[model samples]
Every structure is written in C-alpha cells, then in structure tokens.
Target: MDSGGTDIIWNQFILGAALTRAARRVLERDGEEGEEIRFSYADTHAGGGGLPVPALLPVARKALASSAWAAAVGAGDVHPGSWVLAGRLIAALGGLAFEADVNDLDPAAITAAKASREGGWVRFWSHDWFLFLRNRLAMEPRPHFVFIDPPPDDPRGPGYAMDAAILLDTLGLPYMVTYAVDTPGAQPQEAIDQIGRSGLELRGAGLERGVLLGGGAETVVLDILSDLRNLAEVLGGELSVRLPRAPADDYCI
Candidate 1:
C-alpha cells in the first residue's frame, strides 16, 4: 500500500488503497444490488496519480457502466490514461467515482475522462475536499465508507491544519479510514485523541513503516467511529476498537 513516496501525501494514497479494498469486500458481501459506493481522493500528485484510482475502478467497471464512473473525474494534467483506467475499473466493479483536488487540474484530463463516456458514473471536481464532503452528506446518506488521506500538517513540512480539522469534524460519520504519519515528537494518536474529545470513538490503529535499511518511519492508520463506550470511558480520551476488519487485512500492499 506504499504510495511510492515518503511524504504523508503519498501515505494518504496508501491509506486510500487500503480503504478502497476494504470497501470493495464490504460491497461484495451485499451481493451487488441497489448498492452505491463512492471513493474520494482529496489530494492528487503526479508520481502517485494512478495509485488510488485503480482500486475502486476495477470493481466499478464490472458492476456498472463505464460512463457511470467516468463522468466524475475533474479535468487536469493527470498521467496519460489515468481517468480511462479509473473508469474501466469502476465500470467493472459497478460503482461510481468522484475525484477532487484543491488545485485545479488540466482540462485535457477532464476531456479524456468525458470522452471515455464514463462521465455518468465518474466525475471530477476542483474544490476543497471538506466542503465537498459536507455538501455530499447533505444530499446523500453518509457514504457507507470514507477514506480521508488529507495532507499532513507537520510544521516542518508542507502540511495543512484545515484538512485535519475538516476530517476531525467529519469523524461523526459512521465509518471512516484516515492516514497520519508518526514523526519524531508528533504521533497520529494525538490527533485520534483530539477527535475523541469531540465525542467520536477510535476503532483501531495500524502502522505503515518503512522496512528498508535506511528508509524513514512508518505511517499509521487510525480507524475511527462513534462507539466503544467502555473503552472510551477507561482511556479518558478516545478509545480504539479492533473490528473484524483488521488493518492487517488490507494494510499491506
């Protein structure tokens, strides 16, 4: 699930891939009728542009029409065939797709996605992810599953508190999967604690560390929800529960 980069942005893609796979299994269990799944990636990068797109696309294409998933991707200078591959994947899985970026994307990217005739099932937007989520929630049921891989807010590097804040606020939703790195003196557990203070329960946490000789520390996945009353009481902050859906199930690549 490594996003092929060291930064947290790359880590988000790793988390996205894991969550997408988990959601796919959950969707498969429902027998594929009257079920709708939406996958969102808040940030986009050239190096890892195609990472998260493939996971949900394959399932979507099999379950739905290519146009159903292709209409949602925004136009941008994404890698060649990125949107088409994504549409094909979504159509195969019979699902819908939505991708947004804080920064605007190249029109050619949007044009390619539209040209593929997947625009009905897929669409792209250039906007803040938090706002997009908020708006979507107002119109639809809480996404059965959500992957929040916002950019990190480390002061030493390119991080954004607003992204974390938005996610923290949205944690009230039923099921969510998020990515946070464990830097020196900065543990993602603290963020989990903060979210707990706001009344959400932390379900579980998984670690994604560098295994190579000289690679950096690992990124951790904090599975959260609004349950586990006893654990929350004992911990005095936020308590994490280990569901049947263990991080190890999809944490590895």
Candidate 2:
C-alpha cells in the first residue's frame, strides 16, 4: 500500500468511528465523569480528504460531549480541529477536551486547522511521538486512552519491528489501541511472539477490516489484553482489552 492507502483502509474498516464508539462505551461503563482522557495516534494520515478523519469526527464529538476531560494527540499529518470538534461537541454534553497533534503535520492543513478557531479544543506540535510519549509519561499524568496508528511500512522493515517493540514496552501504561494493516511480510503473530518473548502474553485478536479486492488487503485486530494483564502481574498495574465485534464476513487465509 502507498501513502494514501490508509484512507482506503479507513473507509473499509470503519476504524475511526468504531473506535470512538467503543471508547465512549468504555468511559461510560467506568463512570469516568469529567476525567482527563488522553489519546495518542501515531503516523496518522488524516486530512481534508482523509477517510478516517471525516468518519471519526462525529463519534469523537459524541464521546467528548459526555466526558469531563478529553484530549486527543495525534502524530503525523492529522488535522487537530477535525478531531477536536468531536471532543468539543462531547464536552458540550458535560465534558472537557484538550486535543493536539505533532508539528510534523502538513503545513497547509495545519494552517487551515489553526485558522478554524478550533484551537480551543486542540493543539499541534512537531515532535517525534516516541520521544514525546516517553517524556510526557514521566512528567505528565498517564492518559486514559492512547491510540497508535503507524504508517503502513514494509513488514520486513526494521522500523515496524522497532515500533512494535516500543509499543509492547509501553503497553503497561493506561488504555492503548493500535492499528495495523494486513500485509504479507507484516505478520501480527510475529509481533505477538516478540511481545511474548518480552514476557508479555497474547491476549486475543480481532478483525479490523476484510479484503474487498485483493488477497492481502485484510486487517486483523490483535488484542493484547492478556499480554497486558501478564505484564501488569509482574509490573504492578491494571490492564484490559476490548476487541471490536467481528464482521461476519471478515476472514483471512
């Protein structure tokens, strides 16, 4: 898949909307009233024409409306306000929102987002997400929610493994969710094994998207809740996993 491939996947998977809805349900179940919520999205390829951005906005807005403190921090080129609108809308429903994105966002898009006066609900930054999270987690309060949406990298590339490793190590932190597309070389099972070697267990796996055209276009949702639970047992913390309800037609070879 190329740079714009995520947009296609976004539409096929309905990820943004589904995740937002799931998050809202989780928050409500926890009775998390007006509490600060943090969301970190990696390698976000969202923009004016991006499918995930437009699809996610409404659901996010609804979540923001019901929460006390809700913030979203996206890495890469996602528009801040588009997401912030969701948070702000949610805040209006008796919640609060603080959204921001890394500075490496598209220049034109960033400018447009800035001019939208949606800054009140969001902030943008140009920094490396790994470094940012490492630093922030140390000084800032742990976020209730974290989303990792890395770009579609060659599965054989070291970058994918490195990023996965970092995520596994960082999983002990609050609630976290990540997205990965199905590719030949990028085996989710391999990633799970790697995490397990680090003493983490493989919780469960779910279906994110199914193939619409090609054989390898399917996306699998690997739930690491069991792994997180194992890690927490040794590390001392709480962890959980929630898989999206699988579509009846979602299947892989």
Candidate 3:
C-alpha cells in the first residue's frame, strides 16, 4: 500500500464518507424515540491532528488539491488527521450531537489529537487499542460506530485479530475496519474469509489504494457502500464493492 500521508488521505476519504452515513442513521433512529441522541464514535488508531501539505508526498498533495478534502487543509495548509477530520465532520453534520473516544499508543499522537480544536466531546487516550476495545465492551452506551485502522505490517496486530470483528458483530455495532493489501505481512484474503466465517455478510470495498471491510445492519452497510461508490465516481478511480459471498469462496469485488 502507499506509505506516508498518502495512505492517510485515502483512508480518511473512505472513513469520512462512512461516518457521514452512519452518524446520520444514529441520529435518525434516536430522534424517533424523542430522546436526545448524542452519537458516540471510537477510533482505535486515531493519528495526529494534521500534516503540512508541503510535507506530504506528491500524490497525496495532488489528491488534496483535486478533491473536497482540500477544505480540511488548515491555516498553514496542513491536512487534518483522522480524529480532527472526524470532529469537523461530526460538527458539520450535527452540531454538538456527538462525542468521540480517540486513542493511540503514541504520546505525540494523543497530544496532537487533544490539542486540535479543543472540546470536551473529544476524549484522548493513550492505551493499547485492543485493550481499549475490551474496556469499551462494558461501556453503558456503546459507540454508534467504531473505526479501526491498525498498523498495516504488524503480523500480531489487533487488526489481524478476527475475534475483534466477531466481538463487534456480536454487539450489533456498525464499523469500518481497514487492512492493507500490498504490505509484506498483510493477509487481505484471510481477513475477508474470516469475516464470512463469523456469519456476518461481507460488505466491503476494494479500493485502488486500500482495503476496507465493513459490516452491521443491512441498511447501514448499504449506506456505507453507497458513499464509497459516490467517492469512486468523484475521484474517477476503481472502488470495487465486494458483495456478500459464501465463506472460503475466492474473495473478489
């Protein structure tokens, strides 16, 4: 997969779209109950606040210039990171209607995330992501959506843990879990097959630059994939929607 900030840009592009659709559904559902809905979001691998545009690779900078993401570029032309983008997106979609649990093992990342657009709604934590998820299992109100973007090359990383997906599925949570395809230690097919084995219908997109596997209620999955297709149209790139298939079948888009 592409390295440096290029990968981040592409990853956030899909994530932003996914969250937009998912968050809206949360509000709509809770609104029907006449109860105040404060949408909750959890990011397992929330990175730093932003990156200077000039510091990004040529391809990343090109993507920023050519897409709506340029609006995320800050005062110094810094591209906002995932957490910052999530905060901004949520704010625009539903003001003060959301709270986020953004965590990372890197102190620098946590520090940056806390500093970006300070607000009580965005909580920053320094902890192992797997432990974070385990703890969240007991949360009184589970997050409406979880975004998992684990380290791409670590063979023992939590992203490679199929049981994590099973756990989320059991909770009936909507999530977008990303994995890398062109990396040395990445097992893309195994991850897909494992999701099927979990008895969750396969709902994912094979992006030209990344791999995203998502699952949840049927309506939620359709919304996420619809946003992905819209992104493919805008970017003029191939975002192959991987439809549901039997477990152990050859994974294809």
Candidate 4:
C-alpha cells in the first residue's frame, strides 16, 4: 500500500524473485547450449540496504539446483547492503561459476557500496546504467534474462520506461520490467498495448506488487483479449501471448 523509494517491501522482493525464477526456468528450458541464463538486473533506483534475504532465499534455493544458472549484474543505486546480499546469493545460489557485477551513476552511492563491503564475487561500475547495459548485453551469448526497474528520479521522464519496454521488444530478449503501476491515466495501458503490437510478447503485466482487496489480494493477469482473469488467485498467472499479427502500425492510440 505504501509506495516510496526508501523502504524495500516484501511484495516487490518476493514477487520479483518469483517472476525472475519463473523466467529463468522458462529460458533455460528453451535455451540452446550454454545459453540457459546469465541474469542481469538494472534498477535505475537501487535504494539503500533494504532487499531482505529471507524473501530471496527461496528463489536462490530453487535456482541453485540447476546447472544452467549463471551470473548476475545490478546497476543503478545498488546500495551496499544489496551489493553484499545479491553477491552472496549468487555465489551461494549460483555456485563458484557465477559472478555478481554492480554499477551506479551516483558517486556517493558507489562509495557507500564499497565502503564496508569485503571481498566477494561482486564488482562495481560508476556510469549510466543504460550504457552499462548496452555493453553488457552485447557480450558473448547475450544476457539470457534481464530485469529493468527504472528510477523515479530519471531526468529523461516517463518515456524512459516506454523506451525500455521498446528496447526489450527490439532486443527480442526475455525480460521483466517494473513500471509505475496504477497510474492516474491511460498511458500505462496504452504503452503496454503498443509494446504488444511491437511484435514481441507480454510475459506478464501486473502491479509492482499485487494490490489488496476486501476479500484478498487482487493481482493483474490478462488473457488473449487483454481481459482480467482469476480475481482470487494468489501469485498471479501469466497469459499465453503470441507475436503481433502485424507491425506496430496499430499502436498510435
């Protein structure tokens, strides 16, 4: 219910890990040789130490059992606590082969992330997140999975998120992006419609974390017609989606 940039909430962490795990599974299941996953997460607003280990522990456990699991990278604010937490998780959950790379544009945040952090699989970069991603994604065997959580303070405006959605479409990669849910207008739906029209697919479109209703939590899940479905289900289900029948010509609305 409380939406802010400071405190890390359970819904965001839990649901995000779940979605990441599921996407990892789906990717590995369908990937080619050595292409299972090299997961990278770029959050333009990586807040201070907030992501709890308890929430991500389960996800780590599930992923550790698989040989396809690989490294992870984080960009944006990437608080030091998160740097440590994420690094430990990847090493523990991903074993010795996996690595953790982190970055941020804020010099102070970078300083904070390295101030007390000890040696680990983690490394740091101080630069624009998109530039880091551009280089990272171009590496051998492109990122098998990417999660982009754009910052609220970005000077580029709301179109940044739209551009990211389109980037995922253009890159033709399996991705999960977090946007401002339940906005004051029709633009979110409009963007989603346009992205769907871009010949890519919508793996899932839901709240940053599901919302609570009188009876229970209400999550978003869409069917082929983009109609809401399963009002009572807990973790929210993903709809089956196919590529656009035509180019993005019908997306001007």
lDDT of 4 by residue, 167-218 (tens): 7656665544444444333134455555543211112334243211100010
TM-score attained by model 4: 0.50
Q: Which of 2 and 4 is ahead in TM-score?
A: 4
For residues 175-232, could you state the per-residue lDDT of candidate 3 as single tens digits? 7666544445444445556555211121224323444434543343444455445444
The 0-to-1 C-alpha lDDT of every candidate, in the order given, reads 0.34, 0.35, 0.59, 0.40
Instruction: Mark the regions of model 3 whose C-alpha exceeds 4 Å error after superposition.
Output: 1-4, 32-36, 54-76, 118-120, 158-161, 182-185, 194-209, 217-253
Better of 3 and 4 by lDDT: 3
Ranking by TM-score: 3, 4, 2, 1
lDDT computed for candidate 3: 0.59
Cα deviation in Å at residue 139, candidate 3? 1.4
Candidate 1 residue-wise lDDT at 60: 31
In candidate 3, list every pair of residues with a backbone clash: none
Candidate 2 structure quality by residue, lDDT tens digits, 5-116 = 3233222222333335434543565545557554332223223322233333333334333322223323224434334433443344343344444333356655654554
Clash count per candidate: 51, 13, 0, 0
Q: Per-residue alpha-carbon lDDT of model 1 for 1-253, expressed as tens digits?
A: 3322222222232233333454355457544466565543222211223323423333332332223223333333332233333334444556545342212134554444454443434335444545444555554444433333333442422133323333534453323333333445434444334333221222223323211000000111232122223323322323433221333324321
TM-score of each: 0.38, 0.43, 0.72, 0.50
- Candidate 4: count the clashes: 0
Best by lDDT: 3
